[model samples]
Target: MESLTIRRPDDWHLHLRDGDMLRAVAPESRDMGRAIVMPNLVPPVVTHDDARAYRERIVAAGFARPLMTLYLTEGTNPDDVVSAHAAGTITAVKLYPAGATTNSASGVRSIEAVRAVLAAMEAAGVPLCLHGEVTDREIDIFDREARFLDDVLTPLRAAHPELKLTLEHVTTSEAVDWVRAHPGVGATITVQHLLANRNDMLAGGLRPHFYCLPILKRGRHQEALRAAATSGESAFFLGTDSAPHPTHAKEATCCAAGCFTAPIALACYAHVFEEEDALDRLESFASLNGPAHYGLPPNADTVTLTRGAALDLPPRIDTHGQSVTLFDPGHPLHWHIH
Candidate 1:
């Protein structure tokens, strides 16, 4: 096929940072449809006011009605959930286990402290977006996500059966099974995990830009994610989680964890799905599934992508004295944006 058209896709989870970084990178994603912007800013988006202001900033930066998320804190006000939801400023509350990922030190130290907020969300019919990993130092890095499911999430789900939850950037087979087994739970599979395994980070040499939280897993897990996303399941969808960090920050001694995939996320996803022979189902995973899970309508606009064209993935985005490389800079995508 020369070209394919589908309903505009929304990024179910994204971290656009703030200020110059936000403005510099927002358009690439905006070229797609609405996105669920993460709330893990420096101070963390823990209040309705924070979410509202963040939404306003995103709009001011030229993003068309970006979906906003509240960063759940130990002392998050339950009333804020109602107010934010009522105002239509916050689509979901993000649960980040303290120190689970970037700027997550302000995340909930214990799930117990956020129970009231969760209850409010359940009552308000808002979804709970989760980072899904235990912060316990004893838990091996590779096993944290699975451990969180067994030790924390299982009980949390049982306790909050009414609450809607989404496991973000799920990388393991266990997460796939968990979402499949639970009717109320859904998930977003990131492009990076679907395309590469943990070994990709150190393949020919150490590649820091490929590093991300819930770091890439074994080939089996990569295959599992590919299957889940391309299966056209209503419970599975796309979330680029296209985190970007300054080049200096990423190339430093202890490089920050993130992948700058915004510039080429759709292209990469199209290539992967096409390779799997599931290109026909791309629209569901990219556009329809996420909105359905969140009880929103799919966007009316559409984007067309074409195959058999070469698209040059930028090596780096130079903004305000710093640069950020696009994720998977070495991979050649078979698809190109039209």
Candidate 2:
């Protein structure tokens, strides 16, 4: 093939922080096309006004069309849910278990709170994107995701059969099965989790940049993620979760949990699909599946990617008076956009 061309893809989950960082990084994602902007900002976007202002800022920074999400908080107004969605200000609401990940201290503290918002969202046909991990301190770090599924998500789904859910950055085989079994649910697999396992973070030494919430699992889980992502199933899609943190933050004692993968996300996903010998299905995983799941129109724009090329991803990006690390900083990618 001369070049692999597909509809311009939408990033189902992304974190483009405000101000200079957003300015510095927005273009990399805008160059791709629309993205579902996450709502875990410092104060957290919990209302229609917040989502609207945030969307304006993203547009002001030159993002083509950034979809919005509400950060589900305890005592969140169900009326706000209806207003946000009805106003076209938000595409979905995100539920981050309290303290589950970055800037999530304000996340819903219990399923009761989420149930209220989920009920409103279900009635309005809005999806609930979950950061699937339990915050209980007693749970093993690696077991949090599975525990959340068993203790929380499973029961929540049974109780609210009408709610549409998306399991974000799913890391375990059990998660894959959970999404597969539930017709009302879907999953977004990140490139980092699909390509690397837990050992990769400690392969030679501590690799903080590769660390993320719902942390990477064992190799068998990685294999399951690969199958789920490349199977061309509608229930699975691409969500880069390209969270960028200042380099100083990542190299510190307690590194931030994120991977700045936007610059190389397409190339990395191509590498994975090619290795699976499923390049023919790449468009669906990266482009088509997301819109289908979101009930939005697939992007009409197109991007061309050529194979057999080694592209260098910068070791770190100097932006907004801070340095940010690229996900696979020192690696050479096989695919390059032309």
TM-score of each: 0.98, 0.97
Cα RMSD, model 1: 1.1
**Model 1 regions lying over 4 Å from their true place:** none
lDDT of each: 0.88, 0.88
lDDT of 2 at 21: 85
Give the Cα error of residue 89 in candidate 1, in Å: 0.9
Find the 10 residues in a row with the least total lDDT in model 2.
329-338
Candidate 2 lDDT, 1-338, residue by residue in tens = 53799998889999998888888788777546788899999888999999999999989887869999999998789999889899889999999999999999999788885667778788889889999999999999999999999999999988988888899999999999999999858899998998899888888899998888878889999999999999999899999999988888988899999999998899889988988989889999999999988888898989988977587556887865767888883457778786
* TM-score top scorer: 1
Q: Give the residue spans of candidate 2 off by over 4 A.
A: none
Clashing pairs in 1: none
